[model samples]
Target: MASSNQQVPYGYEPPQSNVRGTLIYYDDFNDITDAALEQAAIVAEQMRFAKLVLYPLHEQTVRRISNEQVAPFYKREQRLQEWKLDSGRKSILVEGWDGKRKKYTPIEAAIRTCMDHYSSPYFLLMTPEMANRFASFATFEEWITKISLVLTRQPDHLHPRMETFRSRWRVAGEQRDKNGKQSEL
Candidate 1:
């Protein structure tokens, strides 16, 4: 039989996506593996070929655009508009990373910051290279990869510090996936 440890997941979809086309979400960077973008690309491709159903989250709701001086007692009703789906379509968030600067930002924010309306259909970047080229990583995989690389590069005398690098996620890909189902924190 093939060694069980030899197998690994080539790609994985993130756990959440309450938005379509523009939603880039993350549980922060979990040390840069670029898993987020990979998932988004796959979903976006599926959406392109099919008449994917639109969710309420994607619909336009009334907005008070400006409240600079107009609101004395008036407040916006930002309710729990939970994103619902009919089980056919899946959504993912995409983002960008700046390798040289060693930072990442939401693609929407980056576009708005440059005052450019141009943006990509995808939003959640999973790989560092992809994130840098794209716009942002909804989750930071770099930190994840960073910590991993650090542990791997540690000096011989620093084994204790290496234990901190050891994470329960280090199990073979399949087991790790199952274990990851629990709360991240």
Candidate 2:
């Protein structure tokens, strides 16, 4: 008789079949080896994927614009009106200021207002390289403070996907801390 510790290749059904001709496992399903589990985890990590979806901040009704439709307008440095899918109509673009062609002025004012309202420091991913460099920080809060300081001086460097990147990092750091505590316990 084979010992319980003997390695069993996956899909190695015993030389028996059910009445329906389906191979049935005789061993306990929960007896997966640690190596097998680790291999599965590695494969999953290799295939892992993520996507960022952006929604309007306060608008209840909004439209989805395809990349192709928006690309030309963006390339030409022209303002495009947001489309409303529910009503099948285009919404008027609201200009924050009159006759000003500055790019960062509006964004800076908005960021300052938000910072004043929150009265707390926050983080921005800024760039892919910056996000990757954040791993060297001692803690997530420290990283946030550093990024907030940079934003206070130069808010124009803020990345378009900063919120998504921040969320991913925050969740990952929380999970790491939880695992550490569990291991200690």
Runs with alpha carbons beyond 4 Å of true place in candidate 1: 1-30, 49-111, 114-185
Would you list the C-alpha lDDT of every candidate in the order shown? 0.27, 0.26
The top-ranked prediction according to lDDT is 1
Kindly give the stretch of ten consecutive residues in candidate 1 with the minimal lDDT sum: 54-63
TM-score of 2: 0.21
TM-score list, all predictions? 0.19, 0.21
Compose the digit string of candidate 2's lDDT tens values, residues 33-52. 44432332232223231211
lDDT of 1 by residue, 65-178 (tens): 111221111111111111112222443212222212233334334434322322333232222322232222333343433222111111333233223434521211111234
Which candidate tops TM-score?
Answer: 2
